[model samples]
Target: MQILIVDDNNPVLEHIQSLLIERGFESVTASNGLDGLEKAQQSHYQLIIIDHLMPIMNGFQLAKNLRQNPNTAQTPILFMSTQDIGVIKNTAEAALVNALITKPIDENEFISHVYRLLDQNTQHQSL
Candidate 1:
């Protein structure tokens, strides 16, 4: 599956990319939300993993833009943030995020969410 990872932190971006690559998943990355949106428009992604806080644009704004674009409207989005999940839960849901993953990423949980989202995408495509 092809995944897009958007984060300002270089190490975190590389870590997630490496993890996905090691597991045989292809990933593309962007330094911030605006860059991410441009990349998203340029290509196709089965899922998107984005950080909540960024310089160019925030994850919530990015998700809102994605929802407005027909090509990305139904694509699953996963947000990674250091912020409290409960604090942003309602906003994330309102923005149409499929899941909100807390950072300092748990390998098992992260991979599980990735696989689950991909499986869901696959099922929808088959239908």
Candidate 2:
């Protein structure tokens, strides 16, 4: 499955990309929200892992935009940010992201969340 990862930090982007790759997952990346939105428009992704703070557009904007686009309306999103989890959680339902993950992420939990979202998508598709 293909995943899109958007983060302003180069190291974080590389680390997440590496982790996903090691798990045998294909991933595409963008440095900021605007670029990520452009990439999202160009392809179908099983899931998107996006950072909350970014240039041009933020994660909330990105999620709102994605929801408005028919092609990506049902795509699952995982929000990763350094912000408070409660704040992120509060906006998640409105933004339509499937889950919120905090920064300095725990690798195992991140992977678990990824699989859970993808699995849920798969199950939804089958239904």
Candidate 3:
């Protein structure tokens, strides 16, 4: 599966890429929201990990646009944020997001969340 990891932090992007690679997913990394969005349009992804606060474009806005596009409407989006979960939910409907991961990352939680979304995406494609 092709997965895209978008984060302004190089360390965070690399860490996520390592985890996805271990899980047998071919991944791409983007430094910011604009680059990530462009890449998303260029190729379909099984999953996308988007960072909440970023320069040029923020995670919520990026995700909102992705969902609006026909090509990416069903693509699962996982938003990573250091801010409170309530705040992120307030910015966008909680149910609209596939999942949310809080920062100071936990490896297991990240894998579990990503796996669940991937499974869901696969099932939907089969239908």
For model 1, which pairs clash? Answer: none
| Shift in Å, residue 64, candidate 2 | 0.5
Among all windows of 10 consecutive residues in model 3, the one with the lowest summed lDDT is: 88-97
lDDT, residue 97, model 3: 72
Off by over 4 Å in 3: 93-95
| lDDT scores of the candidates, listed in order | 0.91, 0.92, 0.90
Give all candidate RMSDs, comma-separated: 1.2, 1.2, 1.2
Q: Write the per-residue lDDT of candidate 3 for residues 1-127, one digit (tens) a residue.
A: 9999999999999989998888788999999999999999999999999998999998877888888899998999988999997777775456557898899788999999998999999999999
Residue 93 local lDDT, model 1: 51
Model 1 collision count:
0
Model 3 residue 19 CA deviation in Å: 1.0
The digit string of per-residue lDDT tens for model 2 on 16-125 reads 99999999999999999999999999999999999988999998889889989999999999989898888667653445788888998999999999999999999998
Show the colliding residue pairs in model 3. Answer: none
Instruction: List ranges where model 1 is wrong by over 4 Å.
Output: 92-95
* lDDT score for residue 100 of model 3: 88
- Index of the highest-lDDT prediction: 2
Which 10-residue window in model 2 sums to the lowest lDDT?
Answer: 87-96
Instruction: Please provide TM-scores, in order, for all candidate models, with all chains considered together.
Output: 0.95, 0.95, 0.95
Q: Candidate 1: lDDT of 50?
A: 88
Native RMSD of candidate 2 (Å): 1.2
Query: What is candidate 1's local distance difference test score?
Result: 0.91
